[model samples]
Target: MTAVLATLNLGVERHGPWTSVGRSGIDKRPVDHRVQARTWGLEGDLIADKRVHGGPDKAVYAFAREDAVFWQEELGRDVGPGNFGENFSTTGLDVTGAEVGEQWAIGDAVFEVIRARKPCRVFAGFWDVPDLVKRFIAHGAPGAYLRTLQEGSVGAGDAIEVIRRPGHGVTIGYMLRALTTEPHLLPRFLDAPEMLPKHHEKARKWLAARELEKSNP
Candidate 1:
C-alpha cells in the first residue's frame, strides 16, 4: 500500500504548559509561478525528517495515518498526548510492522526504522489528562523512530516500501514489553539476530542483574 500525505503540518517550539502547537498547513493551492518554475528548471523543495532525543520513556514518537488512528482512539485526539515533535505526519501506511534496520523509501529519501518509541510524563501535560502515560503504555501505539539511510527529498504523496525485514521474529512491541514487564528478559531479547547495538548493551546489563538475582536467590 502507498501512503499519500493527506496533511502537511509544521510548528515551532512555544513556551507554555504542554506547549500550544497547531497545524501550519493543510490543502492549499500551489502558486502557479512556483509550479511553473518546478516544471522548468527548479527542483521541488525537500521536507525535513523529524528527529527524536532523550531517554526511552521520555522519547518522542511519530505516527502516520493508521498509527494516528491508534493514538486518536487511545488519546482521544489527532496529535499525541505529549509535546512530541513530529515534522512529517503521513497517512495510509501501517507502521506497526516496521522493524529495526528495515529501510523505508519515502520519495527520494530512504530511512530505516531504528527503534520503538517510549512515552513519558510530558504526555499527561500536553493532554491535560491524568494517567496519560499509563494509557499510552496500555494502548501500545508508540511509533517507530527512523534514521536516514540515504538522504533525499520526502514530501506528501510519497510511497513507502519496505526493503527488508529482520531475520528474527522479535518486534518493537516485544522489546518494549520485555523492557517494562520483564527487564530480566533483556538478554533473550538481545539474542535476536536483528538486535541493535544499544539493545545489546541493555541485554548485558540485564544479564548481569540476572546473575546477581541468581546468587542472591
Candidate 2:
C-alpha cells in the first residue's frame, strides 16, 4: 500500500480556557509550502508547556486522515488536517497501527515512531467537548509521536516510505491502550526498546509493582 503526507501543519500560540499555561500550541494549521524539520522540531512551530511537550523524542506528531475522518463523523464536525495538533497529516497510512521503532522517509527527512499521544484536558477543551479525553481514550486511536532522525524539508503531498519496522509488534495503538485502559498489556511495551524512555520506565515500575503484589498476596 502507498502512503503519503497529506499536509504539513505548524502550531501557533493560542490563549484561552483550553490552555494549560495560559497559552497553547495546540492550534495548528496547514502550511502550503515546505517547512524545515529539525532534530528539535518543525521550524516555525510554537510549543508551549515545554515541561510536558516537544523535544527530540517528540519532534513530530502524525495523525492519519482516516482517523481524523472517524472523529469528524463521531463528533459531527469538521476534524480537518491539523485539528488534532499533528505536525504531519497522513493519508493511506495506519498511523495508530504503526509499530514502535518504525521509521519512515518523507521528503528528505527520516523519523522514527516513538510513542502514542496522550489525550489531555487541553485537547478536550480545544474542541469544547467535556468528555473528549475519556472518549478519546475509549476510541484508542491516539496517533503517533516521532523522533527526527534526519533533518530536512517536508511539504504536503510528499510520499511516505516505510524504511524500517521492528518486529516487536508493539504498535502505537497498543501502547495507548496498554498505558491507559489496559494495564495488563503494559509488559508488551518492554519488548519494544524503540519506545520513549519514559514509557519503558513506566512499564518497569508497573511490572515491579505487580510482582510485589503477587508475592504479598
Candidate 3:
C-alpha cells in the first residue's frame, strides 16, 4: 500500500534523430531534492515533444525500482533508477499492476494512473538498441504514465500513499498488451470506463475496424 520514491528524475532538451521533432526528454538525470509536480508535468522535467512525450494524460512516468533489478539481470548491466526515463523510480509498489484510474499521493503531489508507456522508435533510439521496444513490450513491465491530480512537491525518499484504487482489473500491463500484441483481449480495456479516453477510443476503433473487415471479407 506504500512505496518509497527512490529517485526523482528531470531532464533537459536533447537532440536526437529518433523523432521528427529532433529532440527527446528520454535522457533524464536524477534530482536529489524536491521538485514541483503540476498537472502538466514536473516543473523542471524536459519535454521536447509535447505531442509524443508529455501531456496531461502522460504527465509523470513511473517505474518500479524492483523492475529495474530485473532489467539489470536480463541486460547484464546496472539499470539504475532514472535509467528508464521515469520521473519517479519507486519501491514496494507494483507500478505495472497499477489499475487505470488508480490514485496515489506522495509528498505534496497526487497522481492518477491514466495509461501505460508506449515504447516507440524513439524509445529504442534512446537506448541505442534496435530491439529495445520489442524487448520492453515482451517484458510486460512497461511502467505507468500518470496524470497529476494535485500540485505538490515530490522528491526522493517520500512514501507513496494510495488514495484510490479502481476495482477494474485492467492494469497497465493489460492495457499495454491489448494495445499492442493482444487484440483478442481488447474487450477488457474497451469495457473499462476507468481507462483513459484516448485508449478507450483506440480499442473501440480497432474493434470497429475488425468488425468491418469481417463483414466486408
Ten residues in sequence with the least summed lDDT for candidate 2: 193-202
Task: Determine which window of 10 residues in candidate 3 has minimal summed lDDT.
Answer: 11-20
What lDDT does candidate 2 reach at residue 192? 93
Candidate 2 on 117-211: residue-level lDDT in tens? 99999999998999999999899999899999999999999999999999899999899899898998998888998877778888899999999
Candidate 1 Cα RMSD (Å): 7.3
> Candidates 2 and 3: which is better by lDDT?
2
Error of 1 at 108 (Å): 0.9
Residue 92's lDDT in candidate 1: 66
**Model 3, range 1-217, lDDT digits (tens) per residue?**
5688888999766787785587778877898889999888999998887877778888899999888888888878887677788999899999999999899999988999988898888778877789999999999999999999898998999999888988878999998898889977887786678786777777788789989999999
Tens digit per residue, CA lDDT, model 1, 82-173: 23444345566556555555667656666666666676544466456778777766666566766655555555455667777766655666
- What TM-score should be assigned to candidate 3? 0.92
Question: In model 3, which residue pairs have backbone atoms overlapping below 3 Å?
Answer: none
C-alpha TM-score for every candidate: 0.70, 0.97, 0.92
lDDT of 2 at 195: 79
